[model samples]
Target: MTKTQARKLPGYIFLSLTALASVFPLYFMVVSATNTSRDVLNSRLLPGTALFENFSKLVAQQDVASAMWYSSLNAVGTTVLALIVCSIAGYGFEVFHSRGKDRLMAFLLLAMMIPFAATMIPLFQMFADFGLVNSSVAVILPAVATPFLVLLFRQSARSFPHEIVEAARLDGLGELSIFFRIFLPTMRSTLAAAAVITFMTAWNNFLWPKVILVNNSYQTMPMLISNLRAGYVTDYGVLMLAVLLASLPTMVLFLVLQRAFAEGITGAIK
Candidate 1:
């Protein structure tokens, strides 16, 4: 190899090893999911024929369907609402300049630094006062908009063309119309990234949902998975199946939106 190739070889090997390390657990989970609980105790990598049986058992033991439904609802709802709210707020922050606007955005960033655990009681109380405890709304409402997401949108919106907004205004398009028509379409990649992020966050959220969703029927997938692990005699096969089921959507979501997400982030970086 040339000097440059020789120098880069270690880096490439390190990256390859890191990637394999990252992927192995997921591969093991899938392999385990397809095997019997007893068979999973072995370290073999091959998939077995017990996949459906494990899943069937998981469904029988827990309200997997209801958990999935609630989780999906929370994820989708959060993604949609966050995109709508964050995009608008981002656009406004970037496009509308006034006194203290920068300070307000900075304050919002500071708000993100406050740990979620610190505000959980107050947030729960707010929901409880509204009679929304044990409801999906409680799970969805708190994270419908977040400071980090708002910052993401605002930063991404900085790359948006300002001249178009001015032209739209000149053509008598209202601010909202211009935003919906011009900004939303232009920011598809950013929106996709945010959507994936929000959906994943909601789908995988354990803390707030665990605290708020009191009723068994409304418990989310993460809670269900936790239950599987909580028992003293844990079934590895069943747990793997639950994990796979819980993981599939986020994987699918990333696969679908990865291109847009990449473009959005790279665009912002530029």
Candidate 2:
């Protein structure tokens, strides 16, 4: 073979292996979901006829519909609030760099460095004082302003053209109007990326939710999965089905928003 052809062969092999590795778990999950518990434990590789039975058991054991609705509400609420608050904070810190604002920004960044575990007790106490324990608001409030998102938005905002802001100001637009109209529209891709990240984070968050949300009624998919796994006689088929259901939202979000997400990253990096 030619030298160039030989070099390309390794790349092709590596790509194929990586693709297989990524897809293998999904394939296994599907197989497990279709098998009975005994078959799943036996590591049966083929799809079986037990999928409907397992799904029925899953639905009966957990209030699957209610859990799904609650999870969706929590995830969506947290994502929307976090996106708006963090993006605005990021934009503000970048565009309005007064000494006070800069100092506040530094403090916010420092807050991010403190471990979430360290602050859990204090945060819990504060929530208790406000009588917000076990509430969806408890989950949404704490995460509305994520430090990483603030930093990301700040970086992306640096690419915004100052000339556009000046032009908007010359047109006698209010600051809020300028932000909502000019800045937001121009940063659509950046916001889209942030939305995907924030939504995924909220959807997958386990620890804080586990701590704050006590009742089964308020439980998220992660909590449900944890409880299911902790059962004495675990059904791997049912567990796999639950996992697949839990993962659907983030997968859907990525599929829908991937183009904008990629453009945002590329634009920010450029």
Candidate 3:
């Protein structure tokens, strides 16, 4: 090989090894899902013939369908609400040019530093008082107005063309009309990124849902996976199968929107 090529070969080799190491756990999990419990405990690295048996056991023991439904509902609901609310807040922060708005945004950003554990108790008490405990609304409401999403949209909105807003206003379009018709459509990439984030967060959320959703009927996929290991005799094969099922939606979503997500995070206008 040439000298330059030889020099770069070590870097390429290191990256390739890192990539393989990152993927190994996922490969192991998928293979374990097809093995028996004993095989999984023994750290079998190859696929086995018990895939159907593990799936059957998982289905028989858990309400997989109901968990999927509730998780989907919560995720979709949270994504839609967060997009609408945070997008509006972001648009206003960037375009309206009002005094103290920056300060307010900073305050909101600061709120992110406060861990969720600190507010969990008060949030629960408030929801319980409103008779919303064990409800999907309780699970979704607290996540809809997150600061990170608002900040993400605000940063994306910074690149939005103000000339379009002024032109639309001169043509007698209302502020709301200008936003929904012009701004929303223009920020599609950021919105897609935000939607993926919100959906995944809502779908995989464990601690908050576990605390608020007291009813077993309203369990989400993460909760279902948790329950699989709650018993005395843990079925590692079935547990891996449940984890695989829980991971599929987010994995598929990321694969589909990955391009948009990247563009959005980097503040691409298109």
lDDT on C-alpha atoms for all candidate structures: 0.89, 0.88, 0.93
How close is every model to the real structure, measured as TM-score?
0.95, 0.95, 0.97
Q: Distance from true position, residue 132, model 3, in Å?
A: 0.7
Superposed by TM-score, candidate 2 places the C-alpha of residue 65 at a distance from the truth, in angstroms, of 1.1
Q: Roughly what TM-score does model 3 have, to 2 decimal places?
A: 0.97
What is candidate 2's CA lDDT for residue 185?
A: 87
Model 2: what TM-score? 0.95
Candidate 1 stretches greater than 4 Å from native: 1-4
Any idea what lDDT model 2 has? 0.88
Error of 2 at 41 (Å): 1.9
> Candidates 1 and 3: which is better by lDDT?
3
* Clash count per candidate: 0, 0, 0
How many pairs of residues collide in model 3?
0
Best by lDDT: 3
Q: Candidate 1 on 114-219: residue-level lDDT in tens? A: 9999999999999999999998888888887788778888888888889999999999999999999888898888888888889999999999999998777788
- Candidate 2: misplaced stretches above 4 Å? 99-103
Ranked by TM-score, top first: 3, 1, 2
Which ten residues in a row are the worst by lDDT in model 1? 261-270
Please report the candidate that would top TM-score against the real structure: 3
